[model samples]
Target: MAMQLPTCTGIRIRSMSDAHVIFHAVTLGILPIVSRRLDIEERRYIHSGCVCVWEERSAAGEGSSVTGIERWTDGRRWGPSRVRDEFLYYQEKLPEFEADEELSALIFGSRLIKQTYSVFVDTPTGRRKWHLGTSVRLRARARFYLTLICMAS
Candidate 1:
């Protein structure tokens, strides 16, 4: 399925539902940054609401289906200069920690949507990494949290 996004410059991604786990692993995998890298005195709010996903059958009689996920502007319209500034800040700070090219690209290029920072991750079998143990652990943790929420409610 196709989704129209807001008219703003920023990063957009198309990946499986488990993308957040990858982000979490990457963020916690490295040492924390003691100093803030952003120069903006005001904290820009990040709001993600518009999300769409659907399946499209391949026309080649392959019976294949593809899913798309996208997240738009972080609630604020950052101008060109601001986008560049954020990109540079991350670029400078990324080296302080250990991150692979894919992670770095996702983080640094997250603010240059104008013909840049486009990432496509394939989730099909054999195309992506599958950490079964980690996945199970995370699922158990999530279930525990959800159970707590349900009990509280």
Candidate 2:
């Protein structure tokens, strides 16, 4: 609903009761750096929480619906300037990801919110990718890990 997000610019999503699988698939699909290429020095964190399905939802309801919300901030800064570009690229992709029929279904169905995100980066010879995504129903743990991948191109 009325989400007063962290000062940092990011994407927010809501998933269904069993949206773990879908969310992860969608996230990994976007993480260009991770899905296509990967390297070491890579660690992704996932935090799940609940939030309102509607933009008008309340904060009281958005209590960590995100099951896997991590960041690539470190990768953005320490990696290469191209890495920062990756972050910006994915940050811009959030709306499209959320617009997917499947994503909309999971988030709206839960009545419980799911928030996940990450910042992307295109390092030199090496690349770093990180993003946080939430799934209400992580019945499958893979959903948790996969959603943490880059959510941008």
Best by lDDT: 2
Candidate 2 lDDT over 1-153, as tens digits, reads: 232222221223433323333334434443222221112232122122421111111133343332222322312112112222212211111223437888776654433123334433333322333443332333333454466664541
> How accurate locally, in lDDT, is each candidate?
0.29, 0.31
Name the 10 consecutive residues with the lowest summed lDDT in model 2: 50-59
lDDT string, candidate 1, 55-135, tens digits: 222234332433222222222333342233212111112234578999865655443222112222244421322110011
Maximum-TM-score candidate: 1
Candidate 1, after superposition: displacement of residue 84 in Å? 7.1
Per-residue error at 41 for model 2, in Å?
32
| Count of backbone clashes, every candidate in sequence | 0, 31
